[model samples]
Target: MTDRELDEILTTRWPAVMRRVIGDDSDDWMQGFVKSIARHSKRPSWRPSAKQAQLMQRLVADLSAPPEPAMELVER
Candidate 1:
């Protein structure tokens, strides 16, 4: 993908995906993950490597999928 496309996806779509996947109260791991990806877009002329592109595609896929049902606790 072009740098422009990468930038657009990271800037626009990724936030929504992160919100859905991580929620408002994100943990350290999730925060670190966001920072790592954010670094690419922050740099000049950023384009994802093959592996990063694959991972980004997977994240986009997650955005399309319906949220899974929350499990209810049973009172035994």
Candidate 2:
């Protein structure tokens, strides 16, 4: 995809997914992932490689999946 499109995804779409995945907590891994993607997108020569695009798509899918159900203990 074009740099502009990537930038839009990174700026607009990704943050929403991040919020869903991590809530308000400071997740270092997520922060670093965003920073890395942003850095690449900002580079003059950068456009998302096919693998990068695929990875982003997978991440969105994974993050958007419903949260696992919590289990409760029962007292006898």
Candidate 3:
């Protein structure tokens, strides 16, 4: 899938779950956070705004669920 598609999914889902999981408000770290997310999503290019990137990071942290081993390995 394309990075844009992954962006849509992250933007749409990852934040609130991250909040619940980490008890931290990532709602303010969007800029570098988005870039960080793009790196993880393995996207070649994506420039989300600071607010947008923080949101993206939250989303990434949230929807990181997987079989079992991959559950807590999102940001390594």
Candidate 4:
């Protein structure tokens, strides 16, 4: 993927899931994830393998899913 595509995925698409997973630490986690992707992309033989792409696609699907209802405690 092009750098722009990667940036869009990291910045626009990934934040919601990151926020849900990391709570208040989402920004820090996102920055680190972006950095890792950049570093990997810089390697001469680096390209997203099919498995990597599939995993990312699955993550996006999971992230986009509607959250389950929160359970409420009932007093006896």
Candidate 5:
């Protein structure tokens, strides 16, 4: 993948991370994770861990595949 694509991947995964670790998650854990990685990173880019990446990859594949129709389209 190109640098831009890599950045997009990281950008896109940000929401997935928050969804996984939503409310009741420890604040410090989130803050420190961001702060530590943020310090060295080029942007507020978020990269999922290996396991997370696998889950995200599967989620993406499942989403990418077209859904079966609830009912067939008919010609007018």
Candidate 6:
């Protein structure tokens, strides 16, 4: 994916979840975080590392999954 797409996913799409996991909700934290990741890229266009992308995709999937049903108590 492009750098902008990655930025969108990390910043716009899942800021709340990202902030919870990162424990830093300050302004522009996500933008700085994304820039740090993108800084290591060797490509002409910036992109997250494969591992980073995979991890983010997993987060998206986990977030998108339906919640499990609550178990009913069987009190005698």
Model 1: per-residue Cα lDDT over 1-76, one tens digit each:
7767786788789888667656766677766666678776777766678987887878788778887999999998
What tens digits encode model 6's per-residue C-alpha lDDT throughout 10-63?
A: 565565555444564435855465445545543556566688788666666666
Q: On a 0 to 100 scale, what is the lDDT of residue 59 in model 3?
A: 59
lDDT of 2 by residue, 1-76 (tens): 6667667678778877666545656478766665577667666677677987887777777776887899998999
Ranking by lDDT: 1, 2, 4, 6, 3, 5
Q: List where candidate 5 sits over 4 angstroms from the true fold.
A: 1-6, 10-45, 70-76
Tens digits of lDDT, candidate 3, 21-62? 356434555445544554565554545556755665555654
lDDT of 5 by residue, 1-76 (tens): 3456446545675445444434436477654553443344455555556664565455445545676779987999
Stretches of candidate 4 off by over 4 Å are 1-11, 15-35, 38-46, 73-76
* lDDT (Cα, tens digit) per residue for candidate 4, span 11-55: 577656455545545567555654465467567566666765565
Model 1 residue 44 CA deviation (Å) reads: 2.1
| lDDT, model 3 | 0.53
- List the candidates' TM-scores in order: 0.63, 0.54, 0.28, 0.46, 0.36, 0.50
- Candidate-wise lDDT, in order: 0.75, 0.71, 0.53, 0.61, 0.52, 0.61
Off by over 4 Å in 3: 24-76
Candidate 1 wrong stretches, greater than 4 Å? 24-31, 70-76
lDDT leader: 1
Where in model 2 is the C-alpha error above 4 Å? 1-8, 17-31, 73-76
Show the colliding residue pairs in model 5: none
Q: How many clashes show up per model?
A: 0, 0, 6, 0, 0, 0
Give candidate 3's error at residue 33 in angstroms: 10
What shift in Å separates residue 43 of candidate 1 from its native position after superposition? 1.3
Structure candidate 3, residue pairs in collision:
14-59, 15-59, 30-50, 30-53, 30-54, 31-50
Worst 10 residues of 4 by lDDT: 17-26
